[model samples]
Target: MTFLAVARLGRYTAAAEVLGLNHSTVSRRIAMLDASMGGRTLVRTAGGWEITDLGRRAMAAAESIEASLRALGEQAGGDPVQGMVRVAAPEAFTSAFLVPAVARLHRAHPGLAVELLAATQRVRQNRSGVDLEIVVGRPQVHRAYATPVCDYSLRLYATADYLARAGEPRTVDELAQHPLIYYVESSLQVDDLDRAVQRLPASPPSIRSTSVFAHVEATAAGAGIGVLPDFLAEHDQRLVAVLPDDYAHPLSYWAVVRDGPRSTAVAATLNALDEHVRSVGVG
Candidate 1:
């Protein structure tokens, strides 16, 4: 189990947190597993831990055992939706949708715990640690299921003061004159966002950040015209849409889960998230 946790999470500290054990204990167990297996299973890398061929075989066997145990528990009527459900998602959606969904789930299942990893990256092909992932575009995974959660729009926004100081651009060509605030091009991972940025007219002077929240704040503070999600920017009274109808990028949020029988906790979490997204339509 310790080996499985380590392999899934890729970091000793993260595995320890999930397993509710100290860092030393987790390390010792991995060492023992290596000794018993007669080969190195995992190696530390710049990105994280990389699993070896031997480790892949071990993981496959361990997963089968785990599935059998879960089936046995269900057969004995011991299936209860209570435990940890880890999720990886974008920061904006985590605050706008997931936090409230988890809160509601907690009220019904007090024994349930959730760990949310705020990230803005593509869905990893090897989804080891997280039970669920919410991404900006439709994900293509070999062994996973994806469902569209909601559609949102990204449009040009600016503060009234900024617009007054630098006249608003009436056409896409004219946008070149004003400064823009958006994600740093080099750090961006999602293709949908990249395409959106590519479609926009080039603006020389701009503020780039890795965070959408920062984009909203800078635009509100009269930094520059920001391409921001409507769900996030529409609520801020300080921001005014620049070209509501003329310029908009439509995007969908998708929920992804591993392709197999889900644990009770995972099922509950996914259901709760779906319900919340439906209740509050984004687009």
Candidate 2:
């Protein structure tokens, strides 16, 4: 299972999550498998894990066996809804919203297990091993069942201490004079934050991070004004919105599923996600 997962996802960490094992365990299993075959099954490179030709053949055979087993189980009337649901999302949204929502989902359906894949940025294309992918902006995949589930907005924010010390900017022009915190230009995947900065004249930022959670933390620690998602920083007592009228940027969340018949578990999980979004009124 671990070998198959690695071949599919191209990352040991992601494969580990799907297999319900630690990354080291996944690596160990792969190593053992390689030893059993007396050949290199996978190679680790700068990009990530890559399966060899032999490994690809092995993966195909494994998948065939898995499909046969699944068909047999279904014929035996196995519990279709009782299984794992892997969800992938951006880090900030996942930590702020999806985690709690998934917890509620598990409470409602204890048989369903969830594996969350939190990425710092979105890529145009990659080997994703998750069942459901909740993209903050538009997903690049055209063949999948992608839909805009909800929309959320981002706004400029600062810590109360920073505001008190530096004085809050009242307008976009004034905001240019103050230090800013934002995502690194080269690494940004979502257009929402990019749009927020584009609305204002370019200013030198005091801090730049790839992670939105890091932006929130730096802003809360009095680093500088940061453009953050409303749901991520709304309830925090330390952070306050600034230039709400001029700085808010709207962005949509999309749910992407593969092209196929929906499994009972996947459908239920997707429904739970949509329900959670509506319940929170973040849209």
Best by TM-score: 1
lDDT scores of the candidates, listed in order: 0.84, 0.76
Best by lDDT: 1
Mark the 10 consecutive residues where model 1 has the least summed lDDT: 257-266
lDDT per residue as tens, model 1, 1-283: 7777777666787778878999999989988888988999898876467678888888787778777877887799774667678899999999999999999998988878899999888987764568788999998876677888899988999999999999988887788888889999999999999888677788878889999899998999898899999999998999999978789899999888764325578878888988998899754
The C-alpha TM-scores of every prediction are: 0.80, 0.71
Residues 1-283, model 2: lDDT tens digits: 7787786566888778766899899989988999888898887766566678778677777777767776887799775556677788888768767887888878877777888888755543545566677777777874467777788888888988898998988779998777788888888766655677887767765788887888889999998888888888888889988988777788988777754225567777777777888888877
In candidate 2, position 8 carries an lDDT of: 53
